[model samples]
Target: MFKKSVLLYLLLAIGLVLAACGQSDQGSEDKSKEEETTQGNEEEKASEESGSESEEANDKEEDADFVAAYKEGKDELAKAGEGEEVDYQKVIDLYNNQLQPLVAERDGNIDQQISTALEAGKNGEMDGQVVKQIFDKLTQKVFYLTIKHEFQEIDENWGKKEEVNEEIAEAKEYYEVLKETVEKRDAAYETNMVDQIDAGFSEIEKAVENDDNLGFQLGKQVVDKTLMKTFYLAAGAVPNGYATKAAKEAEEDPDKAKVEQAEGWAFYQSISEYITKYAEEDAKIIEKNFNLETDVKELDPEAVNHAFVRGLSKVALHEYEESEEYWGEDKSAITALEGALFIDMIASDIKRMQGEDAYNTLNEQAQTYLDAVKSDEKEKAMEVLEKIEGTLNSIIEKAK
Candidate 1:
């Protein structure tokens, strides 16, 4: 009986061991399957993200290509307008070799149409009307680019406060007008206006070269005025033949000539109001900020010129009296004070030789001018202006 009981115990132990092995194998296989599934899902998600990034990149590339093509076309058109012969074949080659491939990827028809136009133009099969149409299309493209470029330029430079605040404001105003003019460009006047703008840009470049802020401001003003004239022309505010008529009338009638002269002066006054109003403020800022002892040689000629012109204009218009409002109870107006300060700063050595009394006399004369203008005494103001001019010239001569 004891031997039979031991055999039963051994059989039960063996059966339990086999069951445990089966369960271990099953768990291992299930875990392997889950890992494979998880890996596959992760790979799919990564691939999808990569595809989205690629698509976005391609879209941006296409936009850049479009802008480049438009700029190229407009540049070519501008060259033609300048009497340069248009190389239609070269343009066609560029389109086919570079631009068309980009368009092809997107299934666009623009490249094909442009190719056809260039071929037609090259073969001399296109009529004047067709040529005009092509040029017009190109000009329109240029207009868009001009607006974009100008706005970008302004935004980039707007933060640079190396210039006076008033000058910066004027530049912003001019840029705004230019943007609007480009947006609403009349087809008939496009070439003329663009030419004017280009000329103004040249002047601005010159101003930059000379380090003259006032010149830059005036150049930009010219561009603004040109754009305004173009706008007015398109709106028929000025008569179609007004220029010729005005010219002839000036030649024929003295009275008509005087009227036109007065009209011109009125226009000048209207446009220069801002300059007149801010001249004193600018001078005050300069006075407060600039250290004449250290910065005398480095003084901005443009600022000095701006102040000089403001004073000259006021005197010419018999509006010197109005400038007193800017002075309040101050002994001297801003321009006179600025001029005297400039002399003191630039000619300190000469001032030392001439004694303090001479300098005091100069200040007194400037004060006298301010008093004369405040009292509406034109004759006295004129006399003071002449004396001031002579004294300033003498000081400048001595400094040299």
Candidate 2:
């Protein structure tokens, strides 16, 4: 009986050991499968990320190519305006080959304009200079508005640092194309517009680095208003602007004056929305005065000119009001700077009408208000702000 019991115990122990070995093998196989799945998922994710990066790079390259093509087309057309013999067939072919596809992609009224202008050029129906102005200035308007659109995207994606930074970069790229236009205006007008715009862009960069939304907002306003100032200089800022040029040439050379008027209208469209925001009636009047479709002989250059002054003056007043409302805060400084920028937009006109000394005094007071707001000196800011408002109001009244 004892021998039989020992045999039974040995068999049971053997059975338990075999079961343990089976369970250990199963666990090991399961772990291997899990690790394989994890590796596969990581590889897939990496592939997707790489694809996305490749797409972004391709899109950027495409835009760069498009800008080059645009420049080539514009330059070719401008040569005709400069009295250089241009092969119309060559320009048409260039447009069809390079510009048409891209312009079609951005299809709008602008596409129609481009097509019509090119057709006219091909058929010898439009002057080359007019074609050049249309292409150059209209393309510029698109870039300016694109910069605005990018800023709106930045605002929408404010907390997403990478996304916001990307939008800012795009905005800067658009502005880069516009910098030449600003520089040209500066050369003609003897203004420090390029420096002002550069400072605004620098502020934008610094604000982004620090993740200060308000600073970014303020910086955007400066860049925006300064660009508006540049457009104003091109369109209506007296002595040298298209508005004045058109008026002076009207009696002597109606055709040339009409071209100048067209140029003024094209340039004004770039900043019309901003002006319309502050003074809709004035915007309408200005538009009517510059519109080529209107009776060119009956066009009132003075009305267009004064409307711009009134519109900008109203914008300044509105900004100062905003500054006053946001007192004791960063917003005050932002709007104050904007107000000052608008005033500076018409600085030459201000000096002309109010005299250089008065203009200087107003400029000084504006700087004081901006500084006071930044330093949190509410009393001083308010005092200077009131004076600024008074001056702006007087200017608006006179513009009427």
> In every candidate, how many clashes are there?
0, 0
Residue pairs clashing, model 2: none
- Estimate the Cα RMSD of every predicted model relative to the unseen true structure: 32.3, 23.5
**Model 2, global lDDT:** 0.74
Error of 1 at 328 (Å): 65
Local distance difference test, per candidate? 0.41, 0.74
Tell me each candidate's TM-score: 0.27, 0.79
- Give stretches of model 1 more than 4 Å off: 1-36, 101-113, 127-182, 186-400
Candidate 2 displacement at residue 216 in angstroms: 1.9
Worst 10 residues of 2 by lDDT: 16-25
TM-score of 1: 0.27
**Residue range with the least summed lDDT across 10 consecutive positions in model 1:** 16-25
